[model samples]
Target: MDDPLAWLDDTAQARQAAGLRRVLAPRDVVEPLVDLASNDYLGLARDARVIEGAVVATRTWGAGSTGSRLVTGTTRLHAELEEALAAFVGTAGALVFSSGYTANLGAVTALSGRGAVVVSDVAAHASLVDAARLSRARVVVARCSAPDEVDRHLAAAPETRRLVVTDGVDSVDGGLAPLAALHAVCRARGAVLLVDDAHGLGVRGPGGAGLVAEAGLAGEPDVVTTATLSKSLGSQGGVVLGSAAVIAHLVDAARAFIFDTGLAPGSVGAALTALGVLRDEPERVAALHRAAAAVAASARSAAPELGVADPTAAMVPVVLGEPDLAVAARDACAAAGLRAGCFRPPSVPEGTSRLRLTARADLSADDLALVDRVLGEVLPAVLGRTGVSAG
Candidate 1:
């Protein structure tokens, strides 16, 4: 008992030595900086309309959702959001959760069990991996799919009841999963394909329907999709979309849904409004893709050896090869009044760290130029490349 708490100090010291200690500093308001770190791809987070909707809902419904959804939490706002979300993503039904993480937890655990096997990509999001862990299913890590790797995994595990789980877009590298091919593999094996479209909703597919829709798998009986409203939708919450029977099963069986409080009324209202915005302004999705591609191209031109992948959506990761340098580059961008994300060690599976930049629809050509300038100046120093000059 006397020494039980001493290990905490030792662990903290170890993290500090490795430069991996994390801390929180809450911002009071927007700082005078160009932000590339945020996941607000549609730039609607602070939009007047979205904010107004939230305000109206708060006034009408009171602050919280009140209690668990099964009790007194369900409201008309929540119902409306679910209906709109299901229709938007081309699903027969949808169920909302407190966050995208919880949505993944619910979908994965509910759909599969000890008798099932979850074939997941090596690079799937942390939430999905955690869901697989909690599922009590045999999880097989498949090599990140090209167009054929998924089929290979399915073939190898032919006798098992399988569920193929993959990110619609790889979060760190911004590469897309081959959903159409993966869906075909699942179909051939009589398995279910679950695509987590957290980064793809309101950014990819027709009318911002998401990646599953883009691959023509949205209405397929063997496919399911999950997404975050906090990203391109500019709201707060998550949803699982699939066949009516699947959603009905989750409503009764998913522990995250049964135990967690319903999404706040304000978030439901904001999400509903954002969906309407997407319906009327489909061009915003195109703008986001264009911005991401432009950023990737600019970074490649500045550092020909950086190996910037052409983004399939709004995220772009500029590889830096080492962890300490990635953090240094991120700090330099912050110092230059441009904020970008740094990914290292556990956050990235490949052991190569990177600067994860998210392109927003509101970021202008001038903003992109500033990003290029900051990185060109900072990256060489961070990467320890002596003679390279800033562009």
Candidate 2:
């Protein structure tokens, strides 16, 4: 062993030199700061009903599912959640997984194989990218997020099964995908379409039904959708929705689902209760949009030249060209009693490092003002350091 561990040090140093190293900051269970960093979009994480659902389920089911769903995992509660999700999203069937990542891995790999060609959107979430790579199909990256690129790729592919993969909402820049047009192209090309609606679920569409339902594409025979419960439903699980045939195919072939432990019993109960809450109080969805709109307006007013865009799905990104500057901006926000998401390389492009500001329905007027005040003071400094402005 001639300095075997030295390579790791070298790699770490290189990452540090490029300002791409990451560090974690733990927080209290109850921090006084306003949160614009977490994925709890509808502010349901701490809801009394959601919490009660989790507690009751946990006490009944003993915390975790005993095994994979095929074994000892499936329960009466799981069936209920799946049925509720399918009905909400207008799908004929649904499957629950341990996480969104595994849902993608299972969906993509099970849907497309050696004889199929998978055309993927370049801006898709990393999970979708990984799933595409693992699909064992000839993976082709679309030229852009536009439907034309996907259509062109499918049109040029061989006379084999075709699958088109994209995201409903871009995770970084918060841009929306043209789901309707993309679906049209898929239909014309006789290709199955897969939309990872992780960012769009529980935020977009009527009463938070999701982007697929919003575009009137839900329940389409050739369409499949995946989403996580962690973001909006304020729980931990992933779900796949589509026709019964597709669900059966995944249940039989998706290794990720077959091999991994089932989702926690608590999460399933919380998600089920949260879904009911959303159905009863759909106004939470509207409140979420109002919060996002308020945050976007503040970002614009803070640094017009910084060029922050409107939130497409409850996310506002203020791009800073340098990793170090983005870190500095994050630190400034933290010091100002505001917690925002800081994204660097790998999460975003090299020059597009940014503060990812997420909106929650619970964000009050005072919280919004704090965000506005903090960004007003912080972004200008970021712009100045990057030579976009003078401090």
Candidate 3:
């Protein structure tokens, strides 16, 4: 007789053979190394002010949210964050969720259903992909090479309600989507545009208002936006911004929002504090952009054969064809006193494994110098290519 879990071994063995196995390697709290893997773009995760905000909230409220938002989890802090997020993003209203992943689910599913059509970009994040699959709508994936593919898909879909989903800045190569053009297509086709601005908020646009605001699409009746507080905000929650009507609909109909527990008081307070910090220090956004450009330039210099381009946001991908080479590159970075992210199959495509480096506004000259040295030493040998130089 076969064991009930016999398939697990087969899957594990297949993954190991393909070099797609993953393992956790947690870092020390007080390590003497520079971090280029995390999404803390503003470096406010450890800010004293943000920490105090969390501490005060936990002391006053409880550690957990206690219940769902419709129940006892709706605190004054949550209300405050919602209002501030709406105002900053130039939307009519906002709703807070336990996490960005759930927020995307709530937005995509609630906005589309049976007899509806959902169009998604080829390079959308995994959360968005999962959301589209669960939405129960007719899904159409737009081709990445063709700019007019999404518009054509929207035009060809039946007269049912259409929802177009895309990322403001793609999480993989850090390339920016043509939001203004897409918005025009949506407007013409009587479809709504939903942008996941997780990578764009607090890094792109003026004063970090995000790509929607940058394109003058914020507060538009046909546009909806979702973002995470965990990235640039240095907090731990997600938000959805749209018209008042859309907000009301999600609160009433979204299963993800209705069933999920509310965001904790500490996370709400921390996000509120971080938003305040962003408002007060807009210069940090500029610094972050400069750093992203610097890192991308360095990557291109180190491996011109890779054809790396300047990133539109904080993510810089150093493409290595095979998974083993990508892992080796990451290990080399760690040995050189740096922390870089390793992206393998599933996170990226099968053949395009890469080292994903994120930029923080607080990186110093020494940090960049270290990056140059590490890449110069690792890229040439691991990649086995010429024209490799350190920045």
TM-score of each: 0.95, 0.98, 0.97
Q: Quote the positional error of residue 299 for candidate 1 in Å.
A: 1.7
Identify the runs in model 1 with alpha carbons over 4 angstroms from their true place: 144-148, 156-160, 385-391
The positional error of residue 373 in candidate 2, measured at the CA in angstroms, is: 1.0
Clashing pairs in 3: none
lDDT for each of the candidates? 0.86, 0.89, 0.90
lDDT of 3 by residue, 109-189 (tens): 999988899898888888889999999999999953354888889878985699999998888778888888888888899
Per-prediction RMSD in angstroms? 1.8, 1.3, 1.8
Report how far residue 262 has shifted in candidate 3, in Å.
0.3
lDDT of 2 at 322: 82
Candidates by TM-score, descending order: 2, 3, 1
lDDT of 2 by residue, 28-76 (tens): 8989789999999999999999999999999999789999999999989
Q: How many backbone clashes does candidate 2 have?
A: 0
- Superposed by TM-score, candidate 3 places the C-alpha of residue 87 at a distance from the truth, in angstroms, of 0.6
Candidate 2 residue 133 C-alpha distance from true site, Å: 0.9
Top-scoring candidate (TM-score)? 2
Give the clash total for candidate 1.
0
